[model samples]
Target chain A: MKLFFGEIYDDHAILNEEESHHFAKVLRGQEGDVVHVTDGKGKLAKVEINSISKKVVEGSIIELKTDFEKKNYYLHVAIAPTKTMERLEFFLEKATEIGIDEITFLQTFHSERKNIKIERIEKIIQAATKQSLKAYLPKVNDLTKFNDFIKQDFENFTKCIAHCEDDIVKTPLKSILENEPNKILILIGPEGDFSRDEILNAEKENYKGISLGQQRFRTETAALQAVFAIDWELKS
Target chain B: MKLFFGEIYDDHAILNEEESHHFAKVLRGQEGDVVHVTDGKGKLAKVEINSISKKVVEGSIIELKTDFEKKNYYLHVAIAPTKTMERLEFFLEKATEIGIDEITFLQTFHSERKNIKIERIEKIIQAATKQSLKAYLPKVNDLTKFNDFIKQDFENFTKCIAHCEDDIVKTPLKSILENEPNKILILIGPEGDFSRDEILNAEKENYKGISLGQQRFRTETAALQAVFAIDWELKS
Candidate 1:
């Protein structure tokens, strides 16, 4: 059975434009074909196709299964976009596959790229979700100033910033993961790295300084490495 | 400081044409400036620039520092290149950052791309090495037929092949990492995966069946995940 993501309403629903074309042309679904659809908000519905077309695909819900929400542990990373969009997209895709809950773009002092194409990034996320068979679509925040995001009220979460400055300020990410929290947020800087003032601002906002091991990683690699380390720690 | 990779005999020699052009025009090296050069075989030399030009950069070796070799373990991941060249480049960059020793592209039953831009990949690896300040460069093997490469003998190493099929395979990567010997080789299949005959042939060659984890990972992600998991296990 093919699975799709869409809005679910009163027993009947239509797949989104992209999903509709995928089902009608790619999958060749006809009337009475069984398929699964998710609202991307924790709702999974088993449906039978009632209508199929390139423009629209309608289905009747056969059953709805609400998943047991997993532990509330959340992984959010705010990092500057890399020069190559492919690197940033790769970061987003792998982070999603590794179970990240949210992602944000920061316009940092030393950031190489300022503008981010949200549409392109969203498509990448969607493709990753389908590949991973994940129902939860991560919350992709619009590009924002690093200082502004730092000032946001992200209480009840462990806040940390990963940098490579030559300082004694170092703590392993595993330490925080072992605490068992509902939310966790980490910040990864750009290739040139975060400016002094940015670090001070993050520190003022209670973002603890941390390091992702000793090797110097590219912007996207550092972000995904932080994601993987934290996720593994939580499970172990 | 600039960095360059060269052959064994050229260990303490001046930068060559391409490297010198990179150092002079691209990196803008001048007299009395210091730079790092690697033999790509675990030797690094710090050199001071005596002259600079587009054709050659004259530098004398000032100090030679040979760091301790990485753990006895090694990783050789045989995977199919993704459709997009940039995605494949992502694999090259991140795999280097996470410490992979070798990468080989195999023509699988469902491989879409056959030809690869070797020169482009070399550039990416060089950039990754300089960014990570690594002395050892992972060897990138030319794309080869799957069976041809698999037929070779792999002595004194634990060899495993990861497949998506459900089977009675008992070689969990976690255990392999814990009990790893001096060398390790893991072969990840393509997007369409290995055919039944390919799996059977691997079994005949004593290639144990292994699973990366619960999640279904893309080719590049699986490759890097294996690298990180093995590295982490050894470190711990």
Candidate 2:
């Protein structure tokens, strides 16, 4: 069965431009053809095409299922963009496949790329989600100043910052994630790493120091590795 | 100090083209400058430059320390390349950063990519090897037909294949890697995955069936995740 993503519960569904083209031209679905739809918010709907036009594809919902609940934990990763945009995009695609709930791009003192195109990243995330048969799309936040970004508060969360500096309280991400708290966030720095002041500020804000591993991983690699480790610990 | 890669036994050292250009032109290093060099076989050399030219930078090895040895375990990941060359390159970069002994690109039954630019992939491996300050380069093999690729024999090796299928034995990679075997190999299929017949053939070949996790992952993501997971199990 072919799967499509669109709005659900509104009686009529309108496919986005990309999705419209894919369904109409790529898959050549016609009126009355059955298709699966996801709202990208954990709602999966079975729909039959009511009309197929170049600009829009309208469908009628035949069946619906809500998948709002996942296995109990949430994962959030904030990291600097790599100097190369491709690497950052790779991180987004893999992180989504591995089930990260939220991703924030930070502009740290040593950050090489200060800006990112969120639209391009969103397309990648959507494609990855669809490919992985996931109903929920991971949220992508715009780039923010490091200090300002670190100020956001969380509820019942174990926050951690993965840094390279010695003398910081450090443990493997797996060890810290053993208990598998309901919500967790981890910070990964750039190639040059977070500045001393940035680290100090994050520490003051209650971000515990954590290490991904002994190897010095690139910004994006470290973020994905942390995601993998977190999932591994929780599942094991 | 600037670093260069050399051979452990090479008393006479002429820096490679990339390194010589980087040190002499990029960094403006002059004669009498002390620099660090690694044979990339596990020997570190403290050298003083005696000559500098456009083609070669010759340095006198003032002191050398041989510290390179094989890791207690080996990680070899054989994966089918994505249609996009960039994705395979990204996997190579991350795998090198995290450390791997060998990488083989296979042509699976569903593989869209039939050929890979071996030179280009090797360049990425070398760049990553230097960036991560590693003493060994991961051996990269050319694209091989899946059937022929699986025919190779191994001794004292634990072999496994990662595929998305309902009937796969699906043991966790962690459990498969728990004994810390000296040699390990994991195979990851391309996008669209291996056909049912391919998985059965591997089962006949004495390969273990393993699952990375519950969430679906891309070809490259699965490859690197296996690399990280196996290393974590071995090193932990």
Candidate 3:
């Protein structure tokens, strides 16, 4: 069954305009057809389509599942947007499919691209979530400055920064993840890498320095690696 | 200093036409300029430009470095080409940057793409290898039938096949990597996934069944995840 994104309206669910169009026109969904709909908030409903239209698709919920595929840990990654938009978008798409909890576009000292369209990234996340048959939707935060971001408190989370700088004593990600903190926030730098002062600032804030691996990875690859490493560690 | 790909001849090295053009035009490399060159065979050499031309740029080896960044384990990933060529190319480029020993295009029963232009893939690998400043160039093998590929003996290498089939008992890749096989060959299926018969054949050949993760990953994402998983496991 095809999955649709929508909102619950009393006993019925109504898909958004884009998803409605996709259902009615693209998928050729018709009235009386059964489909799965996710509310993007841990709700999966099996509904029978009552009406199919371009603006909205109305369905009556037959069965509902809550907290579907909920993970024990939360992973939040803050990364500098790559110079190319496509790489950043690709990271968003893949990271979503890989089961990230939250993402932030960091405006670091060496960041080439300081701005991002949050709405666009959110859409990508939603699409990936549906494609992966995932119940939870990862949150995409607006672009935040490194300086400001560091000042914010993540009191309950295990914080770490991944950098390529050789001077810093960096622990391998796998080693750090062995402790299995319930919540993890990893900072990934840009193509030029995080400035020395930025790394120091993060360190002063208690963000442990970590290394992904030996090979030099691009900003997007590093971001995905961080997500993958966290997910892998959690699973292991 | 920029790195160029070349062939060492006696006490000198010669750059190919593409590299020669890049040296002479893009980098404006001049005679007597110092540059690094890699033979893509675990050889890195510091050379002085002896002559610059469109066809071939000559360089005299000033210093040589061997086995610059050789890893303890070898990783060969055989995956079916994604229907979209860009996704396959993206996988090749990222896999190269992340480090791999060899790549094979697998012709599986459900493979959407049967034929691939090897030259194009080779170019992507070469560019990524140079971009990542690696001493080794990953070998891209010709497309092989799934049956024929399964028949070939892997000798002492650890062979594993990653599939999304739920009925089969699959071990986590990290758990399998704990045994620490010096060499690994991981087979990733196509978008449609490997047929039941193909999976059974691989299992018969001692290809251990492994799961990348819980999420249903796209072909390209799965390929990269497999590569990342192997690299991470070996590093850990």
Give all TM-scores, in the order shown. Answer: 0.88, 0.91, 0.95
lDDT of each: 0.79, 0.82, 0.88
Poorest stretch of ten by lDDT in candidate 2 chain A: A64-73
| Candidate number of the best DockQ | 3
DockQ of 2: 0.63
Candidate 1 off by > 4 Å: A17-30, A52-56, A68-72, B7-12, B24-31, B51-56, B68-72, B115-117
lDDT of 3: 0.88
Q: Write the per-residue lDDT of candidate 2 for residues A98-197, one digit (tens) a residue.
A: 7889988899999878789989988889888887777788988999999998898876889889998887677777678776677898888999899888
lDDT leader: 3
What DockQ, between 0 and 1, does each candidate earn? Answer: 0.47, 0.63, 0.86
Interface RMSD of each: 1.4, 1.2, 1.0
Question: Best TM-score goes to which candidate?
Answer: 3
Q: What DockQ class does candidate 3 belong to?
A: high
Which portions of model 2 show Cα errors greater than 4 Å?
Answer: A10-12, A16-18, A25-28, A53-56, B10-12, B17-28, B53-55, B62-65, B68-70
- How many clashing pairs per prediction, in order? 0, 2, 0
Model 3 CA deviation exceeding 4 Å by range:
A9-11
